[model samples]
Target: DQQVKQNSPSLSVQEGRISILNCDYTNSMFDYFLWYKKYPAEGPTFLISISSIKDKNEDGRFTVFLNKSAKHLSLHIVPSQPGDSAVYFCAASDLSTSGTYKYIFGTGTRLKVLA
Candidate 1:
């Protein structure tokens, strides 16, 4: 089966606090991973990505870490703001594919940043 899983349906965090999201996968063949953040009704925007060759990636206030051996990954956001409230999706792709990169997304985690 294709891999990648985000178990939580939603997360609530107070503004200025840290938010953590979790994900898991079953397919070992996946070598590239990405995280996307989406506002209501809008398409997801790329947040950060990490290659299988690396264990971690960070961008501004967002960070992602991957543990290949355990098939797990996580997203971390610091100083969460109300504007940060949105749906987050975890996606993975196979690097061997050519031309196009197809992404398999998780069900989605809705993060509500409380003011």
Candidate 2:
């Protein structure tokens, strides 16, 4: 069973439009969530995160919303630009796990911004 899943492998949007990415989890124990963005050949960089205790978190052009009851989450980026083209990964962790945080990542969604 996939604990974390990004059903859409890719998304394309024109510049200045809005882009939305979705993610789902099967494990109820996951309590912390994160979104990471990566460019080609580089490691993923943290974008935003939300704790199970909260429902939403935002940073600059990115926003993440979590529905704990539904075990679902999403990332939204407005005014998508060419520089936003990259692979986005959704990750989750059980912070209570042995008092350590280990990340479980989705396969990743590639976003392309059309200039």
- Each candidate's lDDT (Cα)? 0.90, 0.95
TM-score of each: 0.93, 0.96
Query: lDDT tens string, model 1, 5-114?
Result: 88899999999999998989888888899999999889999999999999989888899999999999999999899999999999988877634788889888999999
Clashes per prediction?
0, 0
Candidate 1 wrongly placed segments (more than 4 Å): 97-99
Clashes of 1: 0
> Which digits, one per residue and each the tens of the lDDT, describe model 2 over residues 11-115?
999999999999999988999999999999899999999999999898889999999888999999998999999999999998876377789999999999999
Give the worst 10-residue stretch by lDDT in candidate 2.
Answer: 94-103
Give the runs in model 2 whose Cα sits over 4 Å from its true position. none
